[model samples]
Target: MLCVGLDPDQQKFPLSLQGQANAIFTFCRYIVDATADLVCAFKPQIAYFASARAEDQLEKLISYIHRHYPHIPVILDAKRGDIGSTASQYAIEAFERYQADAVTVNPYMGFDSMEPYLSYAGKGVIVLCRTSNPGGSDIQFLPTTDGSGEVMSVYERVAKSAATKWNTNGQMCLVVGATFPEEIAKVREIVGDMPLLIPGIGAQGGDVQATVKAGRNKNLMINSSRAILYASQGEDFAEAARKEALKTRDAINRAR
Candidate 1:
């Protein structure tokens, strides 16, 4: 599935949209309408909408998409992962409230913190193993001694666990950034056939060819955000976004 992250920041939004909620709605609707055929899923970053209004309104926008475009799956990129009962509430908010088909989660909080969301049968829990950020290497690449006294990177351990242990129900997936192909390949081997959510393609300078060659699996989903959504800053932005999304989607399919 090709997932497009719809994060509309005020600073990046078209100058014409200035301070209009309808503008945000219109921009997203047109992009969704244009690119829905190219992609299997749409990921709307909750922060983008929440930055404008409350979470309830953001939930409504999600509901609007699911109601109108029932065929496309909606993945909420909230990255919700917390301790204790907070995880359960987040599950409720993401699943019961927004009805997200999938959600990106942080595994740093450990397995128990993720249990609440992973318990669901049909829903997907994409754990962040290696993010698409330059600073991500700071922690993800840290070396730790295993029980056998061999040292391994933190992300390697996470990928191995997610493949062999964490995803008992087959709903768990790992987030492997496209920016780093070698790292992506390593994680792919550890995670085996598990689905991978790959971000950071256009604006982040990730090579699409290398990303697909290394990360393509039966369940891999190559994600692009700013490249598609912000393809243009004018009235024809949505059409521009569609063209870009199609290019990315076709490229991904060919590599796969």
Candidate 2:
């Protein structure tokens, strides 16, 4: 699926909408109007809105999108990871408070931490495996001896663990960043048919072609955030964003 990420930064808003929550809402509205037909889903990274103290407003925007655009699934990118009780609260906030179709989460805290969210079979839980950040390799690529005495990467182990042990709920998917095509391909093999939510294609300098060829599955949802959302700061920004998204979508389809 073509997933467009709406990770808005207020500082980059158009001059006419500078420093306003309404501006962010208006920008998102225009983008939804522009690219709705081209995308299967819209991902709003919770951290972006939360950082601006617009978490409540963000929820309202998400709710409005759901009510008006029921055809488009909304994925809340929160990367939430905690124990059962706290995770229950998070699940409520994601599935009830905001009424999101899915959410991105960190699996570093283990299975029980993700259980409360995964319990909802109709909803989705995307567990972070290999991130796009440059510093990610410090921990994720660490070497460890496997049953065969062959060295295995930390990310490989994480992908295998999630696909085999934790995917019992069947709501499990993985967040494999686009920056590492080889790692993504490996994860794709381990997960088999499970959906993978891929991010970091645009501003992160990830190779879109390689990412599409490597990480994709029939269930995959490739994402592009800042590259499209912040494509322009003029009146035609929405149209520019739409063009960029369409290019990415068509490119992905071509690669597939």
Candidate 3:
């Protein structure tokens, strides 16, 4: 259930790793090695690496995970949303270049953008349904009609469509924020047992017990980014991260 997010921020890094070369990879490598046994997946938000001009480090980090922790899947949190050739190229970047087991995508661009990723045989394509940000309600909570003239919220429609229509390969999933347990339950009701990539835990103030109670029936990748990554600002950062990851993992299991 635990999916530790590698959202590395140098400003928050321990002094020891702040100015080191390949610091991004080194920071994430420490976290991965420390918590690999405690998590089901690792989600690397590409923006953090890209903003630091460390895409090469991101590549090396993913490769290291695949080589060292073969059982764990890597979910590249790029949230790419494009159509046609552009979407195809993004798919190549995620699956071919990074060799990630799964990738997060923006469904706002509709089915055409998702088709390119779904074209892959075993890779996963996770859609942004109900995000953790408050502004997401501005759009996701709006009422809309499904294909059959059924009235439902936009997020609900996304759940219905992904489960029934877009999941032609059985590899589709949804991104539901853990902050809104009610909406998470609503999505589960709409999608049955489809897996969900849940974020908004830890620093975002989402409760572990409530999140688990809402989505425990299906596979969930409950993520924590800042809280776990910055568990400590000292040389023992990795050890502290492992401890935090263990705490989160145990809490999710207990709730189940």
Number of the top TM-score candidate: 3
Best by lDDT: 3
> How does model 2 score by TM-score?
0.95
Query: CA lDDT, every prediction?
Result: 0.84, 0.86, 0.93
- Put down candidate 1 lDDT per residue, 88-144, tens digits, no spaces: 999998899889998889999899999999877799999999999999999999998
Q: Taking the candidates one at a time, how many backbone clashes does each contain?
A: 0, 0, 0
Show model 1 residue runs off by greater than 4 Å.
none
Give the TM-score (vs. native) of candidate 3.
Answer: 0.98
Evaluate candidate 1 by giving its C-alpha RMSD to the native, one decimal.
Answer: 1.5
Question: Model 3 segments beyond 4 Å from truth?
Answer: 146-149
Model 3 worst lDDT run, 10 consecutive residues: 209-218
The alpha-carbon RMSD values of the candidates against the true structure, listed in the order shown, are 1.5, 1.5, 1.1
lDDT-best of 1 and 2: 2
Among all windows of 10 consecutive residues in model 2, the one with the lowest summed lDDT is 19-28
TM-score of each: 0.95, 0.95, 0.98
